[model samples]
Target: MASTVCGWCGDRTHMTMVTDLYQLPEGLWPTKGYSATPDRDLPVWMAAFRCPNENCQRLSIGWAPLHRAKMGPTKDLFLREQLNWEPTQIRRPAFPDVPKEIADTASEAHACLSIGAARGAVALARAVVEATAKAKGITMHGIAPKIAAMREQDIISPLTEQTSHQIRKDGNSIAHGDIGEELMSLDDAAAILEFMDALLDEVFQRPAKLTRLSERGTQQAPGGSADGATPVQGGADFSTPH
Candidate 1:
């Protein structure tokens, strides 16, 4: 069994090995299973993996290949490489609290990041911010205006507004081709993604959490007051201890 992230459920769990490491057929090996050819010293293989999550016991697959190196006549080589394994080994994060439209755009941005399209991710990060603003009923024409409006409405804090403006500028540069994907570093992509998550959390998740808290506070038990106290016939110091 191997551990990998389930792409479907997005869980970090074990995957039961569904098959032994099977060597690729010689007939199909020529095309390298419709992918790039393997190195001369490496051979292709396939394996099946099934998720252990009962609700998500779906099957996934991957390709495994062994790399051989010859050091001496008596030397034996042993190393294996697997591509596109189950669990995707990449995060496809979910912004459940964000509005559906904004969440979808953010997901695409994350997909680009996971695939190493750093500039595309950054460009789309800007789009996500715009979508979030629109979801909040902000009708400004640009990210800067929208951010300023959000600050005015108390939708975002002053510090966040300042940082968001900077992100908007970076996103604009990337979107207009001023910064190319090859020029964007992985670190930059990661940092921008973190900011996106934080912004979404503040705008959506926090508000939703507060609403839930308010609803709970207003809820009343059957035959009891909203404050959770039940009336007693005698009413002699019936209050519960704090």
Candidate 2:
């Protein structure tokens, strides 16, 4: 078996093996599997998998170097080796266990939401997740897909579907065009960010422990700030430690 240092931590994590069977020629399974074994290289057909950190309970997705031939073939690879495997259409991430970071972002998002600024809401929500992931040593790219997969695993509530969809749309707006006038309202942005923060909190920790806006207060629409700026929401005080 072989090992590599986890990107988030210097701790050397041994490779574990996983295998998945794909339909031949027709290309039925778009994704492949990896073994838990650290030494096994990716076969032309298989995808590589590794733990994001030695202490993490979940695994991360990665492609083996093309020249190495260290993994098994994609189609014939066995999935059983993964033990606790979950297939995803896109790459999955290794989120760390950090609640305080998420709480801070949520607080900022709440403040933005209180103001009713769409752009600010979106920007703050993105910042919260990005910062949380960074502190925990996770990546933000493809985070939406990762959340979607987590939903499918029933690790979080199905209600997350709406939040994931909105985030995807928000990302598209930022990348391709303006956030649009409708998105400028603080209330609209706050609601979306609140949902997003809830989702991240669930992903990083226990689902039951996730935040619920309904429990806190009515889902108020953002109004305007003191100087006629966009309406904003109150900062969230997570009385319970994350």
Candidate 3:
């Protein structure tokens, strides 16, 4: 079995437990030879894959037949194909601090890539950028103007501004039914989604986090030094109310 992707963390590898599964010991694997796909005529083996990533030792439960996934000559489409996974791999990471609308659009973009919709992913990524710009109070008429406003206000770096433009162009092309050599692969889609995440972090997530942290500190901080050695609120005793 070749490497597979973990839906939980998007870790791609030969996640198979033992390099060789044909040599299963007795009582190791229960095999009723269940056919998950009747037309394919191949029985799928379901198991928990061993994750090498210590930071994300997530037990990925997956079902696959003994055949390799379909791939281009040199690249993977990140297509679902015949594999069935528990968590479902999408390049989306958690964005708890972003606005609900923006987070939803960003997840939709990544979800498009998970099913091999590179063009759709690119298009939705453009939407995310525009939405982010608007959320930042840059309610301009067009993407170019909105992005320019963001750049002028230092809301986004020059590189990020460029990414926003390219995504906008590609999305425009798709809107007019002419993708025109833009986003030819899933890797391209992944890149756009990364840009989306960066945009969200820069425009929304970071600021929200900073404000939350500031408020929480003010609410929870003891009236003392940083270290716990200092007395808190003059060593107030709460056993009896004053």
TM-scores, each model vs. reference:
0.56, 0.36, 0.58
Q: Indicate the TM-score of model 1.
A: 0.56
- Models, CA RMSD each: 9.2, 19.0, 10.6
Question: How accurate locally, in lDDT, is each candidate?
Answer: 0.67, 0.46, 0.65
Candidate 2, residues 72-159, lDDT tens digits: the string is 6533233312211222222122234446656665565554443223465576566554454444444446656555555565655677
| Ordered list by lDDT, greatest first | 1, 3, 2
Candidate 3 is scored at a TM of 0.58
* Superposed Cα deviation of residue 100, candidate 1 (Å): 0.9
On residues 66-88, what C-alpha lDDT tens digit does candidate 1 reach at each position? 54454532111211232446445
Candidate 1 stretches with Cα past 4 Å from truth are 1-88, 180-182, 220-242
Q: How far is candidate 1 from the true structure (C-alpha RMSD, Å)?
A: 9.2
Summarize candidate 3's per-residue lDDT along 5-61 as a digit string, tens digits: 556667654455432223223333334357332433233455565667767766755
Model 2 per-residue lDDT at 197? 59
Candidate 1, residue 155: the lDDT equals 90
